[model samples]
Target: MTASRSDALFENLLESAQRLSFDSRSPQLYELESGDDERHGMTPEWSPLYGTPLWNSLTEQERARLTRNEVAQFLGVGIWLEVGLQVALLRAGHSADPSRPDIKFLFNECADENMHSLMFVGAIEAIGAKFYQRDRALDFFGWIFRHFVWDEVAYGVVLAGEEIFDVMQRDWMTDEDVAAPIRRAAYIHVVEESRHMAFARRKIRDRLVGLSRIRRAVSTLIIAIGTHLIAKGMINRRVYEDLGLDWEVVRANIDGNEHHRMMFRRAAEPFIEFLSKEGLLNFGARWIYRKSNLL
Candidate 1:
């Protein structure tokens, strides 16, 4: 409960997770194989390399809009909340016997996430885009990382996001109307998340459930913070901004007043349902869904 304990927990978790970086077969390999799919569809649609663009497509306007979306999608929403949870969990494992495979899997996942951010930025650059941090929704979930958080809560928050993201990627793979660029993104994610989600379910079931009471309490608080962060990130803003729509007006259209919370809920709904049906719906899990206004 002390700050020192918390800091130590984070450090250990990160160290364990870092083990994956040295693993021979990482999602990074899949990314490397994804060469020039944007220019030619030589790879299968399900391949992680299916639609990777070269660095030459963006005009100034297009790049700017893409950069905004990238900041919102990767940095603001994904990295700060999702990857941050992994770091928190790694730290928590310091005092306990953390699963090496799980930590490694998570580390690999972090690598994938980092690559995804790079890929998004690369796509923007291919089209010639630049981004300004000021345009990001900075205050949206600034409260989540203000204090130490527990592992269970952190895991649940991460699991919920993964579930939502996985579902989105699956949909994109199946959608006939999805653009090539989006499909490429989906392909890479699906390949990685297939393992990540499986790992999450096991980690939560086996590892998280066995933690001490103090850890459980911390987990709950972390999950709550994660839930709120996710809820705030679901609005489709950059598209509207690209079209010169007022931010408020776009929010109104996407999340009309009481219905303003719908986007996050709808996106997270399948995960909520899955957890409930699987009997994995802990307070932390439910808290995440509720924060998204899904349950």
Candidate 2:
């Protein structure tokens, strides 16, 4: 991964950013149909409880509400990570040489994330869904992630989070059944994040070159653990209560549903393969990934 390649990527990203930037406050966002009692506020297949007995038993209105809430919660996780990333990014790039192309692009990336968080918050609020909070321990870790991490580790975590979110959002952007406002948001995120992920992956590769096997192995486990937390944190328990379903029961069913598991496996396949080829998917880290059902 040459600095020249990074410079080209950054140049392209900068041009893309200039040509396309948006706010969450657009009238189109406000015009989103009330999907509360409708059939498709979100693509039904993405509901956390999808393919479970609970999902099959849900009424049309209930299903709509659940999927809408599920999508909101997914975006909620992005909001959580993005907030922390804003800090991490600033600190990481704070000392970069101004002459480097990626330096300017780093600040541009930060601005993009700021807008994305606002967009997610606006969409969730518009849909009347809750942006659930992480537990105390996770919150503390999240704060640490937001405030301190950078370098190869931050980009490692960044790629894990972005890849999963990108895969899902890419599907939404093309699926007609997904809500229009949500699709628009997804499209914006996917486009911008493609550049971010490319940049992060390159950074990881560059930094990994001289790291010892022990350090790489340790970092791999940490990255896998971080991803596991993010994956498990996506669906808030309260999203089920709107349908009068028990969270524990619904979660149990979702855990057992081959359909949902397969979805995750498929989405994570390329990412896992990439990490494995790069030697970041070691034995210990593989176990953590399996625990999260992303294996």
Candidate 3:
């Protein structure tokens, strides 16, 4: 689509986003930045799906190491990226038309994202863990403002990221290990994010359908990022660094290794397979993955 058309589509989505309301059952924190869970005492939250056996399976060293590092990673990347991006994207995509539906939906989405981040951070802090203060992945996405002041590409990336979180939300909210308050929070988030995911997919799909070339480029970029960022979804780096592995070597292993291809595919394979089976994987997407050898 042309810039003007893309802008219009964004406006519509933003209008809808602003109108989404939260379930009354969700939790709240009196402090925005304090990472403390007011409902439950300071205990590390884990999905029941991660059985106690699995929890016990980890050695004490592994448990403590992950308790800090992995928690930090979750707070930094997941919270900031998901919450911070929504408001920024909405402000950028807002239109002059007050009646625009997308803007309304986006507003609700931003609110939901903010609440989600606060709860997530609070949970991290509840266990006496530190906030993820330094993360290159989060930094890189934050810095993309120089390229396009209000780029849809950035918005689309955040939407895709939310889908990843949605899966965990669905699984963990229902699992037995989650605390009652936290489970309520997850359930509320799952409902709100469901709408956000639909809008995100619509915005990207419509944008792609308008331009075969851009569609191909977007699909390729999403695949590449999916591979590098979320493939393993493991805490290997924190482990390696804690073990005194050279930071550079650890970074190289994570960044340069081919094994991440599997990880990426594992994380995204379900989505792609769903699209393919639904016959929504178009020629452009096929071409992009075909050239990348991701088929």
- TM-score of each model, in listed order: 0.59, 0.92, 0.62
Off by over 4 Å in 3: 1-57, 60-69, 145-152, 178-182, 212-215, 230-267, 274-295
Q: In angstroms, how far off is 188's CA in candidate 1?
A: 0.9
Q: Where in model 1 is the C-alpha error above 4 Å?
A: 1-76, 93-99, 127-147, 174-176, 208-222, 236-242, 257-266, 277-291
- Give the poorly placed runs of model 2, Cα more than 4 Å off: 33-39
lDDT of model 3 at residue 153?
Answer: 53
After best superposition, candidate 3 residue 64: deviation in angstroms?
A: 7.2
**What tens digits encode model 3's per-residue C-alpha lDDT throughout 1-295?**
3545655765655554456545442344312233322222212342111223434555644444444455446445677567557655766766546445555556666767777777766655545455534446635645553234334455455664666566555655575443344455557667777777776666555545545565455554654453234323333355346645465655554454344344334435555664564344566656554433334
Predicted model with the maximum lDDT: 2
> Judged by lDDT against the true structure, how good is candidate 2?
0.77
For model 3, what is the C-alpha lDDT against the true structure? Answer: 0.51
Cα lDDT of model 1 by residue, 1-295, tens digit:
3334434544554554454323223334224223322232111232211122311233434433433343334323554554466566656655554444444445566776676655544543333233324324434343444346544455666777777666556755555443345445556666665555665565565555456767655555555555655655544455346645566744443333343244346657776665565455567756665655667
C-alpha RMSD by candidate, in order:
9.6, 2.0, 7.3
Cα lDDT, model 3, residue 272: 63
The 0-to-1 C-alpha lDDT of every candidate, in the order given, reads 0.50, 0.77, 0.51
